[model samples]
Target: MAFSQIKVLPTTPLEKLGRVGTNDVYIQKEGSQYTFFYKNIENKEDESIRNFSFKNVENDFENFYKIIIDGFNANPIYDIKLELPNDYVWLHYTKTTSKLGVQFMTTNKVTQSTGISQIMSVEDVKKLFEKI
Candidate 1:
């Protein structure tokens, strides 16, 4: 699961966008198909991050694009300060729009109590993926 060894599966249409620690990011779409996957290299027990697909492809893609891309485009970064020890990764599935949204907070693996945050532009995020 080394970042350098990450590769998109054949016929899957996913494009590697880079890695955050040991988690590899990807985006995929072909015609009406749209999807995303996060491969957790650190978790040898279950390498797949899971939960990207929820049966409704169209709506899921729309929401993912809206919240992760468009929402960030509109509002920029939203930060929260919490004093917690556990790390969390959350995906919000909106019932009204039938779309997906993601939120995550990372705790220093060694420190376990301190959180790490970063700010990046939408364009920068898109640039992580190799040109097709």
Candidate 2:
């Protein structure tokens, strides 16, 4: 099945922020609330949307992006795991050569699922967030 085959879809009215690797950054409506998320095709049987708890999409994402990018700058070889403000979600950053691999993960008491973004250069990743 393709990524589009997933049924647990974003509610509607999606504002595509940009692309980070294979994942598409988006601000979308899920039920009554608006959310920021990374959407992609995941073979795992997890929920379709990986939502971020951003009070302000631009500012909040920028703040977190700085932290993430800064972590990479500090030591490119070290894998960084950051638990997002929304305790259930996490951003895992892995570095390879000059590129970065980012994965968005969600967890509950029983299970954990992940959405892997595309591997991209640090500059490219910065450009992706700048669009938000």
Candidate 3:
């Protein structure tokens, strides 16, 4: 799949970003790019879950992202479980810190309960995504 370089932006207002909030998973698609509003349902005041955008993504990537967002909306952090395809990886914000983290399960074992790596900046998240 042709994944574009992901861009992380500050938590802009949904209207300013040309997005409308749904039951959950606020998203705006501009051409082949998408801007997703990932919120923390547990804490509305949480600013850790920042808005992010990705360009030139495939349908599969978009679908998986949506699934993750929906899962977050429905359940608390501990309850969220992502079933990823083999060799597929994705980024998520840490629940407590709102720092970027990576999630993937190896054949032998799952790395973390949330499948999250150490918290990192958005730029670091982008670099790791690119490397994958």
Candidate 4:
């Protein structure tokens, strides 16, 4: 489902942190709960933008966070960082047009869902894909 359907979800405000230069949002809460979201911008000359309605995937909060953020960090309220078991999966998707034909791309990255939501260096992430 979507974040909207999360049980006991928090209403998070979207902060304008300049031009999305590589930082993410960290949700701190009581108990053992954590939420994260990240996103990156892309430029394409020929590609259709798809909008999936929140009503359709309201149960995939984890997926929603990954779709928006390049990376995330979640932790317990204690003094240490906790690791999310293998149960949590993060996936990202992108569509592009190329000389061959239309390309549909997707990647699922495994991440520890604990510790600190470190603000990534946008430049570093960009260099990873050589977007810069």
Per-model TM values vs. the true structure: 0.33, 0.53, 0.28, 0.19
* Better candidate by TM-score, 1 or 4: 1
**What is the model-wide C-alpha lDDT for candidate 4?**
0.29
Error of 3 at 48 (Å): 7.8
Off by over 4 Å in 4: 1-23, 40-119, 122-132
For model 3, the local distance difference test gives: 0.39
Model 3, 1-132: lDDT tens digits are 754887777753433232223312344556655544443333345433333445544675446545544544443443334333322234443554543333322121243321222333434333333322
Can you write out model 2's per-residue Cα lDDT over 37-113, one digit (the tens) per residue?
Answer: 66544654543656555455556656766766776666534545655445355456676675666555554323355
- Candidate with better lDDT, 2 vs 4: 2
lDDT tens digits, residue span 41-125, model 1:
3446655453232233557544544455554433433443322223333322122253333333344344453222222245434
Candidate 3: lDDT of 123?
45
Instruction: Note the Cα lDDT for every prediction shown.
Output: 0.39, 0.55, 0.39, 0.29
> Comparing 2 and 3 by lDDT, which wins?
2
Ranking by TM-score: 2, 1, 3, 4
- State the weakest 10-residue window (summed lDDT) of model 2: 26-35
Worst 10 residues of 4 by lDDT: 98-107
Clashes of each: 0, 2, 0, 12
